[model samples]
Target: MTVNARSGLPKDRPAAPAPPPPPGWRRWLVPVGVLITLVLLFLPGMGRGPAQVDYGDLAQQVAAKQVDTLRLTADGTITGTYASSFDGGEDFVSHYPTGLQGVDDTFLSQVRDPSVVPHFQATGATGSWLGTLLALLPFLLFLGFFLYIGRAARKGMAGGLGGIPGVGRSKAKVIDAVRPDTTFADVAGYEGVKRDVTEVVDFLRHAEKYAAAGAVAPRGVLMAGPPGTGKTLLARAVAGEAEVPFFSMTGSGFVEMFVGVGAARVRDLFAEARKRAPAIIFIDEIDAIGQRRGSGMASNDEREQTLNQLLAEMDGFDPATGIVVMAATNRPETLDAALLRPGRFDRQVTVPLPTQPERRAILAVHAAGKHLAADVDLDTAARATPGFSGADLANLMNEAAIVAVRDDRTQLTAADLSQARDRIILGQRQGANFLLESEKRNVAVHESGHALVAALSPAADPVDRVTILPSGMALGVTEQMPEEERHLYSEEQMLASLAVRLGGRGAELVVFGEGSTGASNDLASATGLATRMVREFGLSPALGPVGYSSDSPQYLGGEQVTSRAYSEETQRVIDTEVARLVREAETTAVELLRSHRPALEALTRQLLEHETVTGAVVHAIAAGSTADGATRAPVSA
Candidate 1:
């Protein structure tokens, strides 16, 4: 089967042929009818009928023997042919004065001369049929306009923009069962996630098997994870594996500015899904419309109504009907509980960040068509990345390729991958010419301080690289990578982390007798970590091992306001403990830097020379070895 490049759907069979066009003459029938109607409507006005003449002028013309013919109607309108000499016109019309009984004697005296009088006739008559029709033309046009508006109103009532078809309909893109493209094989990792969704795929492919066992399938599955964890990709894999119709949409698609439009869209979406039974309806980012209802004044009535309709549809659909709803959201904590209940989203799959092996696998998948140098070790790259998601890994591979292209190289090398990782984590590197010599020296010292503390601290992760080169918002950076993945951290490890974070500030104070704004981010990070240690981790002795932090979302990063559960006096204690922890960490960093003053100076000087230094060189300098691998005696504080 050939795959469509744009849509990624398979084309195993030919598309259905379009209906034949109508007969040639029939195509012009509507346009011809419209033309005829317009001509008939405007024909009377198009012709210049008769020129109006005054009654006195007509009498003078008749008395002068210039009038050739005359006909007077009961309504006192006189129309007749006249000599061109009378008024340079052959035909004329005149209205008698309404005050006159008939053609008055004054007007009749002009026609009394037998020689002057032309042909004359008096007839009590009404207007011709065409004139009558012309008189009602306005009413007919108004009726046509009213019908056009009424038709538009009816279309609007049917949930469509007036005259525009399918504006209010669901915007889901449906993939036919035969066009399933991304199977499980295409997904690199998330084995557990794939396993969890496999049952749904099986049920979709073979509903009779479950029916025979009297087992009901789950109506919906919710994939909750951090952003870029491949939740949507997993849903696509399910569609491919099941070989069933796939209806995909985002939660935000259901909402519209118009009231009741969101609910209407929800109904329309489900109706379309029902028409394609055994289909998988995947809604990406369901939290957009599935947030907890009536939470606060921020609650949106339209979104709430949409959520209500979705709940109704999910509950209303039968498992036997073979329609499974799958939704994904990074902010699952914000979703309404009804969506996660049994019979709705019976299963909630958590797609967390990839482990080292999974990262390696994901890298391999993204690297399939890319040209890589022989020395580019993906395993090492994976090990360096601890908390990277599948999408991040994919982006990493692409960024590495971009780096290679930027350097005018065809094959991505290890250096390209390393630079890409640094760009991702520490932001893009700034030009070397941007920093002044003095600023560069200070940055070198600051980064050296961080590297020294991280290398010396037993509980801290190993320093990976140190650089005086400015990147992103920072003038310098010291990156540390863990030797292995760690799910939990000890109190010592947290304290060590705090010290490493404050190392730059400590260096600033020790070397320059002052601090700079460069440490502002470090201070904030240290303070927040210390606060969490005291309040959430219950690490502070004064806090009595009691957790005090509110339950905020784990994956979704945002601040939430919550009233402190503890008293004001307890708050004071909490603050005191947090300050003390931060002070102790800073003090440790200061003392460690002071003791390793010679090593710090050596590392800083090396950074000044090279602008970038590896962890091995930093480790060597910290262990009483010079930058050139020569032995040196350690200096005391």
Candidate 2:
């Protein structure tokens, strides 16, 4: 078995056979035929015929006694050989008036001399037929060219630029019933998602078994998740494992500028799938056409028609036919109810972000052939990257390799991975040499405050690294990596998180007696966290145990404007509680900074000198030990 160099998956399918070569004579047939046709079309005009002159020029030449012999036809064509002392002898052809008695008599009188008279011949039917055929040659060629194009378009060739004839054909990429390039092994994790889809594979492989037990397979499976969570990959893996024909198309592929085009495409897609009975149809990003239908100006008639067609096709197909439809979408909430209803999409699978173990596996899959140093720990990397999807993990591994290459190294080290993580999360590091001395000192102090608070607070996550170097939009950064993933947050943890977020502003207030614009991000984060704690988490004493926040989708990362369910008076109280929580957290941060002034100063000095300090050093300093292992008096609040 051969392995894919990039993905590290074994090639499962046999190599396709090369097409047999055509016969040698057949290869030259087209060019020879084209040559023969061209010769036939222009052969009569190719020989040394008379140089055709205008009627007036011929009249002038004949009037000057330049003609040796002339032949005139009843159709008005004239041909002759002329001799001139200045130029030499030449044969020429011209035309004169014919079937007009007065014009012919006048021309004949002008060109006729005492010694010479033009010979006239009657035109034959053969000449007339040849002239008509030559006149219609260009139109015939044009018609033939269009006919060739129409034939190719009907056969769905020329990259599917099928023109009018293929407008209603499905644009799906059809993979045949041979094993595909990807399988379950290619996908790193999400075992539950794999299992859920594997059942579909089994049903396709053994349809008779399911029928014998009177078990009906699901008509459709809907994979809904945040973007880049491997929903589409899962569908492909299902097709690969089952060794069935796979028809894949995106939701936007069905939509077109013309009305009813989308509906026509839907019909074509289902009909094609039916032709290959045991096949799978996978549509990605189905929400584009499957959006909730609305009546009014807001409704899109074309999109609604497409959705209606899709609904009918899904309900029209039988599961026992061994055909299954799979779809993926990031915005499941936007999908129409008819698309997700019982008999349509019977199973809705949620593919969420990878957990820590899953992330480690994903990293390993991406790290297949990459060189890593001994200290490059994947577990540590996975632990640090919480809420990362499989795509993110893959990107992280690639970024780490890039960092290694940037440093002129072949193997990725721990520092390379760290830098890669920082680059992804906090943006690239900016040159600190351009910073003013006062600004540098202020940034060091701000980050030191955050580090000290996080190290001292038991509920807060451990401070991973603190830096005064500017990165992205921040003047300083203090990163805290959680030891493990936590699905639920206690009230204490929430309050400690708020304090850690406010620590920078608290330090600025304590040291300079005022807060700078550097604390803008911290202030915003603290305010939001405190509000969530009070309103959503119901951690506020004044608000009691009732959750007051609106029901917005959590996975969707945007601020949604929702109508408040409570009255104006309750809103006022909620606002007061939110402010109180933020104030309490800030006060706690200020008191902690005031008490551990020595540790804060020590940490800030280390940051200013080295530009970065680790969590261990901060913890040591907070515990009354210098960074270089020197003992110091412990500071307490």
Top candidate when judged by TM-score against the true structure: 1
lDDT of each: 0.82, 0.80
Q: Give the lowest summed-lDDT range of ten residues in model 1.
A: 1-10
Candidate 2 C-alpha lDDT tens digits along 425-480 = 87888885857999999998899889888888888898888888787777778988
Q: Please report how far candidate 1 places residue 469 from its true position, in Å.
A: 1.0
Q: What TM-score, computed on C-alpha atoms, does each candidate reach?
A: 0.75, 0.74
Q: Write the per-residue lDDT of candidate 1 for residues 1-637, one digit (tens) a residue.
A: 2212112223334556775685799789889989988987787689687888998878777877898778878888888887666666478889888886654776666555456656777889778787788799899999977786576566455333324455467888887746567888888888889998998877777766777899887989899999999998888787777666788899988887755677877777777776666678999989999999977656688898889888888886332245789999999888888888998899889998888888988999899999999998888898898888988888899999999888898899998988888889889899979898888888888899999988888788988888877778888889888888788999889989999999998988889989898899999999899988888888888978898766454332355555667898988998899899989988999999998898889988899999889988888888786557643344332
- For model 2, the stretches where C-alpha displacement exceeds 4 angstroms are 1-163, 317-320, 551-562, 626-637
Against the true structure, candidate 1 reaches a TM-score of: 0.75
> Which residue pairs show collisions in model 2?
none
lDDT of 1: 0.82
Compute the lDDT for candidate 2: 0.80
Query: How accurate locally is residue 73 in candidate 2, as Cα lDDT from 0 to 100?
Result: 68
For model 2 the TM-score comes to: 0.74
